[model samples]
Target: MRRLASFFLALYLASCSGPYMGKDLFGADEFVLDSYKIREGKLSILEMEGYSVAELGDEDLEEYQDRIHEDDVLRIFLYHPKRHDIVQAVSEIGNSIGYQVVGGEISLPDISSVKVEGLTLGEAKKKIEDHYARHIQDMEVFVTYKDRIVRKVELAGLVSVPSVPVDGKIRLFDVLSKARVPTDANLFKSYVARDGALLPVDLNRLLKEGDMSQNIVMRGGDKIYIAEPSAASLMVMGEVARERVISLPSGFMSLRHALAEAGGIPFTGDRSYIQVIRGNICKPKIYTLSWEHVIHLPNDSLLLMPGDIVFVAAKPITEWNRFISQLLPAFGGIEFIGKQCGSWGIFVP
Candidate 1:
């Protein structure tokens, strides 16, 4: 009867046990938690693979020529070197006032109209000088650009302002300053898109290293995308006092500092087997470090990087207790089974 009772009890426990507990008992290597292993050196979330910084070339310079378009206002000043009367006559009629370019032509009062649209500032000045050459001898034409169509550059991601209006020539930093980019902006990954092609910019080099080459001249219709800082965070799990996700600040964080943030490992945790898991989900690089040895060596201190996971492995006794805790839910049916067996006089005890 005692052997029969032991056999039934063993069968009942086996039927109640879950596949997860069984795998744990069999020592199946499974990652129950996902985390990052922060490391030393520069960590970049932006894809810098197969990417190189583009140098400014002649083609880039040619794209910046500011040409006069329709609706552009020009302040024209005309002077006749030999004839003072002609200069006085033109100035008295308010000929020096703003003249709107319409249909590619700038009309002179009681004079011939000259086409100036699609021409650069220097080209337009020469065109006006040639027009007055036929009428006035030794004529000087001074063209001053007044109000024109507002040139805009689209700013997206992490900028306080979206659309920025530019006058004359503007640089990449000038637009960012005007937009008031936040401190957390991912400046290294920011880029400028022109003519459907993206040009990666290193704002950190321009700001910190004083690399003037990164300050690219901005043009009208250019789109600047300032990416927000990567959601760089680390998870501290296992035998820590508090298992939580800790957000990584800009710059480096040491393993000791990260452990302190997680409230340190509990007394029951094994300090000799601190595990740091890294890499992709399917194939992860597992590293085991002894806290005792690491604490003694200054150079051996692990610096946490973005998306790192620090796990303080628990002691074997604590793991056994955890295993037992998981099986507690299965024992809820024990009382019902005992009562049925008692009614049938099966002697459940």
Candidate 2:
């Protein structure tokens, strides 16, 4: 029974993917460096600079990120020329000299209120000391972040009404797990919008590759919007064992994973011209990786994300189907356009 079932499954897969089965791609060894296709209406890799995923040695967090916000607890130390009794009493007494920022200001013992909101620790300490200088001859003020109030980021898109709370020293990576973001969410486009501008955060690197450089500090009241890609799953087409759509994995799906999911590179699979099409439909980036390169490189050398389309090219895609025959060298990206058009205009590669 098991043999019969296996035979039937094999036959079914063969018939289902008969047209795509073919010999190895020509010039596999000849192709050296993986490069982009300029004529495929695909966007150049240079245009992806705004995304900032490829930067090196970037700072984890900036000094300005430590700026004061409302509802924060501040530990203030006071010094006086000859008032050791008053200083000791204040530190040993009421609220332990820890003051909370209320209405953008903290009410000290003598000073009515000192505005410290939107200021750094140094700026706040200077402001507080200046405010007290008017009343006291040589009073000093020191301020530090005793405790940051717990704040929640408004997580919008691709989740079940989700929001990630930050108690203290939280990161975008930590809260992303709390949000339970799906693999189908477009990590490349995900960002934290704060103060009406997007922060330089690359969710793809942080979530998929575990790149700490991209793990930005999370702030309260940040709007983290995770966008859905044009396609829910990656389209794996062209000369392979079985052309299909592969759902993205939680971490990342490499080219090997995609190939294995589609019953792997077949006996007749083309070993040349494996293209990984990324970016949007109208302006995609086609990364041409030969099978020789994939075989020799590390498994994670070519990790895939949602909205990626992997195409194992054989010969030119001339006579793919009746409609796409005229399209001329159209590979897996056709399906993306077909989906965007909401019509079965061209057959997917």
Candidate 3:
């Protein structure tokens, strides 16, 4: 009975101990790092300067394809000896709602819905003349074709790198290289939108894709967006060298590179048992593994992706309370001596 009672006593003491507190000399739990706490309430992603890109919707791009003059072309007049007001009036009349201006002096009979994205005055007139021959009773207007610079286009997406304001006559490769399109760009399945329709082009079939040169003409307001590599991505959090989304590449990018991109763990990091939260579905599914194995093991080079949250928990605190408890008997003995000394001192007084 006594043995059983003693066993119960031990169990009770164990239950009474705090989760973090231990009788040992040290604890294994770690203190929290400020960085581990995410910004709460509202998250504002600040755009990086010269690194921001905008995407256009299909509806906005559809306005440029309606029927112009029977012959569609563009034209421009330089030093026509006309006042600026006259020039402006003519340009407005050509572009008005009821009339479509194809090119120099070529106006469609009915320009109900005609818009052009990239065309100078000379070119515009040619388009009008080519497409709306029946609409114009008299095509006698003569305007000079001055290929003047007009509107500009915007391109963004996964690239070898990222840049902004990449103006001038840009090719597909130039923009791709400028954007630093990720290696994971699906060359076999690429898409561009025109008039509310997404046109998929195969990068391998350049001619079929309408790619005349390795370089494709960049229209003003044209944006080239690269896509994420795959739907399956992993979150690399907790004491990692890198903390951003890692698009799985065709070739291998080791764990070291991922860590390097994450800025590596701070000096205060607990090197062992780096934590990775997988899926993060209903609850954060935690995985603990040593750094050595992750770095050395071939299977540990897990591909990372966007929206993966990586966290490195601090080192566990040592169980100093356990050691303190062991010294309790010694403290008890000291108390008795202290009491006796008090009595002796009193008697001498």
Candidate 4:
């Protein structure tokens, strides 16, 4: 009775025009496939694609929003236009309101950080001239980069990266703000690559939450890849009442739910030969199962993840025939979730 009850939960079904033993599964044509039975311990539920949270350290977080970086040379040159005298250089300026002498921090994994102080353009320059540089006839104090860091950080995706003037310390947040990234751009999947290696840049924290710890300073010759989320869906095809593409819900969607959404299977649809082809089209695996038979405990649900292409089959994976050429066109039409199918195509040799 327990076994029957488990099977009952796994599926519930009937015919083509009518309701249809229950509709299900899919397979690949021309593509050589290695098949495996649905194991007792390892089931469909175990293969769910979910988000994972990682713990990060904030040891190098900047107390200030922006700071000067390595190989940067800054100077305080007080220039008085009223008195044509050589711009007097100052050792240090006093602590006045606006932006204080900002000693920016450098973040280099290979070498030690070299800190440099810089000041923004404002009345503060005049204040410095008024108090110290020289009795101001005309407020003429200046702060400029003696040696500016000039290079391009290539950014790809929806964000249009402008030529950011690298005066001193340029951070990730600085670039993103000017990048004109769309509101719909998916930050979670974005990553930064440097020197042929991926940098540990969690854009979600920096962009969405305003987390300063993740706002690492940008370096020259860096490549940033930004991506948008794929259209969330599941493609259901073959031997069903209404073949359709179902939108992925916020929560889990089971085979039963999907079949129901497709208005159940017809008589032509095979109940014993249900095949669930998952993963990407280039390298995908097909799982064959019988909805009529008794499935194990937790596996009864048989939930489907986003982008999972649910299809029906006339025969099981083991009995898949190479002559089955009609499915080739349908399989090729499948669009993977957030990924390209690549160059490989399923064709008879």
Q: Which has the greatest TM-score?
A: 1
Candidate 3 Cα errors over 4 Å, as ranges? 1-144, 147-149, 154-169, 172-217, 222-272, 278-282, 304-349
The stretch of ten residues in a row with the least summed lDDT in candidate 4 is 30-39
lDDT of 1 by residue, 46-91 (tens): 3212134455664443326788889998877677657776566655
TM-score of each: 0.60, 0.49, 0.34, 0.37
The lDDT of each candidate is 0.65, 0.64, 0.42, 0.51
Per residue, candidate 3 scores C-alpha lDDT tens digits across 1-349 of 5875586457546544222222321111210111111111001010111113243334332324222233343343212243455445545544443232344233323433334434544555555444434543334333432233343444445554434432345545555555655555644334444345443332323422444333444444455555556532345555445556665432123445566667887654566645544333454334444567456655323432233444565443322344446656866886788788887884311
Determine the C-alpha RMSD for candidate 3 after optimal superposition of all C-alphas.
Answer: 13.7
Evaluate residue 27 in candidate 4 and report its C-alpha lDDT on the 0 to 100 scale.
31
Task: After the best TM-score superposition of candidate 4, give how far the Cα of residue 211 lies from its true spot, in angstroms.
Answer: 9.7
Best by lDDT: 1
Residue-level lDDT for 346 in candidate 2:
50
Instruction: Name the candidate, 3 or 4, with the larger lDDT value.
Output: 4
- Please give, for residues 1-349, the per-residue lDDT of candidate 4 as tens digits: 5874465334321112211233332332211121111111112212333223333335324333333344455455555555444342242321121122234632211123323333343433444554543334554556554555566677888778644544336777888788887766655456777689666566665776576777766756777776765434677777678889876422235567777888876766667655666776765656655655214313224655556776675433212332234345544554441135344553322
What is the Cα-based lDDT of residue 39 in candidate 2? 12
lDDT, residue 307, candidate 3: 37
Higher-ranked by TM-score: 1 or 3: 1
Question: lDDT-based ranking, best first?
Answer: 1, 2, 4, 3
- In the predicted model 2, the residue pairs found to clash are 24-270, 25-270, 25-271
